[model samples]
Target: MTAAVTTEHREHYLALVGHGDEAAAVDYALGLAECGVSPRDLVLDLIGPTQRRIGDLWARDEWSVAQEHAATHVSEQVVAALAARHRPRPDRGVVVVACVDGEWHALPARLFAEVIRWDGWDVRFLGASVPGPHLVSYLHRHGPDVVAVSCSVPTRLTSAHRVIQAVQDVGVPVLAGGGGFGPGARWGTKLGADRVAADGRAALEVLRSWPLRAVAEVSPLRDSFVSDDEHVLVVKRGAQLVAVAMDRLADRFPAVHGYTAAQREATEYDLGQIVEFLCAGLFVDDVELFRAFVSWLCVVLASRRVPPETVDLVLDVYHDELFDFPRARAHLVAGRRQVPAGRQVAA
Candidate 1:
């Protein structure tokens, strides 16, 4: 009976948010709490998985940005209602949660914060993309037992690395969590976090075992890059590469030449995203990162009626332009391989 109810609730909750019915969703979550659903389960089980599905819906092109945003906002409201209803006293040590710089997805961090708060730790959630320096200052002022850094998008891994290093430098142990850290969050260890968790529930287990770990005992950041300068050079030259790709795209597509200002801007943004993802893949020394991004980009573009072959051309131009950067070229090759063989190289 409990399993049946859980399934029904999951389906109903997803439907509520999908339609942007925030008040109803919040009511439903709170009603579950009233009906003996543990607050922790409400967050980690219901809101968290639903939020991820919202992301997946957007990724699969089944939902537009507006719909995704609406669904996400509803989830946030549900989380808040639950948290407000069950504010456990902070018996455990204080812990701060923050999204890494440039990671605007704060819901994951918020989910962790609410869960830990219910578990009795005082959670200070620094919402949405706190800069490293500012975060360090917050740590100094508050002196939490640890800080959990969240990064959802892989492109923000460089910023995550910097923030982890910066937080550890200031005598605080860092707990790295979020999707950006790659599978199993192996990249989090590479970035020098004291501990890593793949999600809020996993983070809870990590904190329970070692909530007050000292700074000096944490693992130092590993040197993951083969050519450290390649990622940096890609970022530094990103604008130039985008401009070059744009010009070349106009030549190949011809349609780009007739693009309106909005169209041109959007194209530039897409090209820039390609470079950004490439830089991230290089930063983490993972070809799979670039390949994954190319595959997803293909789906996104295809859903929007843009030719996936455009990504192929962009990769080719990037490969040619980054000829001097061996690592960059190699990752681009991986990304190129992800593009469906829509057209042959333009000789």
Candidate 2:
């Protein structure tokens, strides 16, 4: 059937990926393609959702990081196998798909590239974490009709904004995609994309109807940046803030002192992530962004058996440290509420 990969197919394919069965997964996908499931549907409906499920499983602690990575590798292989099997004519214009600088998640961008290729566009995938000047130079030489910037995490929005600015500067229409753009791609509009496509299908819709070479001739929205510049100031204190939180962590949460090397590393990462997410919310002037991230982080830490008080302590330390910056302090307070059974950190 030419229909989307049904639940039956998804479960079957996931089993292969879950077991790290790359050959079986690829063969199964190729079989589906040969049996009439279109390439776009195969990627969007099957591989895409499977990748997400892999993330969910990891966040829930059902899958180890190694397992998650293995499944992801298999999924990548399936995408490549499918691409090699179904070649599309690029009657449409050239499109370059790349992850924003500092964003290492390349699979989503690769998936999008393949989906658009099926739509008859010649897509040049730049893999993950493309730096600014490099991307701009490529735009100059390649002169693509559109450049799709992918950022999977909110922490990358600032990087995404820089890439969007660079692409627009080079006169290439910028299309912002992925979770970094926030709900309804509001942050994408804030960053000044010619258009925002949530996924590859929406990208095709916009690209197909996009006016003739709009990137070369028009700017869809004016460039945007933080008005108050508080985020700029707060970002500079990243290391100092992390050190203070870690320094004070043992006062309330003594368990951290006894952590093994891996646990300590993970704990440090979790602490750093809080600052990154807070800065991201500050960049966009949206407190809810930080709140959502805090909630998600709480769940993730809880799954790993981390006590909620550890978060409370960090937020308290950050709140006190960022006292001079009103917006940063407010975002910290908002994030603190999301921690389960959280206590206010006294200044």
Highest lDDT against the true fold, candidate:
2
Q: What is the C-alpha local distance difference test score of candidate 2?
A: 0.86
Q: What is the overall TM-score of model 2 with all chains considered together?
A: 0.95
Alpha-carbon lDDT, every model: 0.85, 0.86
292 Cα displacement, candidate 2 (Å): 1.1
Off by over 4 Å in 1: 1-5, 211-213, 220-227, 342-347
Candidate 1: Cα lDDT at 191: 76
lDDT score, candidate 2, position 273: 87
**Model 1 lDDT per residue over 272-317, tens place:** 9999998988887889988889988888788777787788889888
Scored by TM-score, the top model is: 2
lDDT of 2 at 249: 85
Clashes of 2: 0
RMSD of each: 2.4, 1.9
Residue 270 lDDT, candidate 2, scale 0-100? 78
Could you tell me every candidate's TM-score relative to the true structure?
Answer: 0.94, 0.95
